[model samples]
Target: MKVKIYGEGAEAQELLDKVNNSLEDLGLSDFMEVEVTMDEELKNSLSISKTPALIIEEEAIDFRDTIFEGIVPSDEEVKSMFISIIGGGGESSGGCSSGSCGTCSTGCH
Candidate 1:
């Protein structure tokens, strides 16, 4: 699994630390690879409009999704998201299995 955190500045750093701690506490620090980026081009390519966005990329499949944006998510939320993604089963927040119901901003469909 590959995780990307996009942002620059103090708030971004804080979020990064929180995410890292959560990953460690969840015992995912060894299995997952993380990258913190401040590249404007990469952020624009991902259409990340807010700072401290968390993107998860699954290596077993051609799947990449943004699970968090803007506000920081709780440790449990982070763990749940990872579990769902890794397990390949979860209800979509957009009410569409494909995640393209026009309600989700991640553009997963």
Candidate 2:
């Protein structure tokens, strides 16, 4: 999986940091490719009309899906989306492989 963050300035950097942290926390940092860009042409190609957009691409399936644009998503939401994209095959050996750990009042196993 490939993740792209498009924008400039501090907001974009913050988004990038959030994404990187999420990937690391989920144990997917090494499995994924991440990039940040302020290129107008690339943004146009993806129809990204807003800054701080997040695009996720799965090359195996020839898919490049946009997660959000012009807004920052919660870290948990980002992690949840990633888990869903990988079909819930997260590296976690616990029951939270279902990726509902965020909703668990007691936390993940």
As a TM-score, model 1 comes out at 0.69
Output the lDDT of residue 17, model 2: 89
TM-score of 2: 0.76
Best by lDDT: 2
Q: What is the lDDT of residue 98 in candidate 1?
A: 45
How do the residues 1-109 of candidate 1 rate in per-residue lDDT, one tens digit apiece?
A: 8888887777677767777887787777898888888778767777888878887777688787666777666555555555555453354453323443343334432
The runs of at least 3 residues in candidate 2 whose Cα sits more than 4 Å from the true structure, single-residue gaps closed, are: 89-109
Error of 1 at 78 (Å): 1.6
CA lDDT for candidate 1: 0.67
Candidate 1 segments whose C-alpha is farther than 4 A from its true place: 88-109
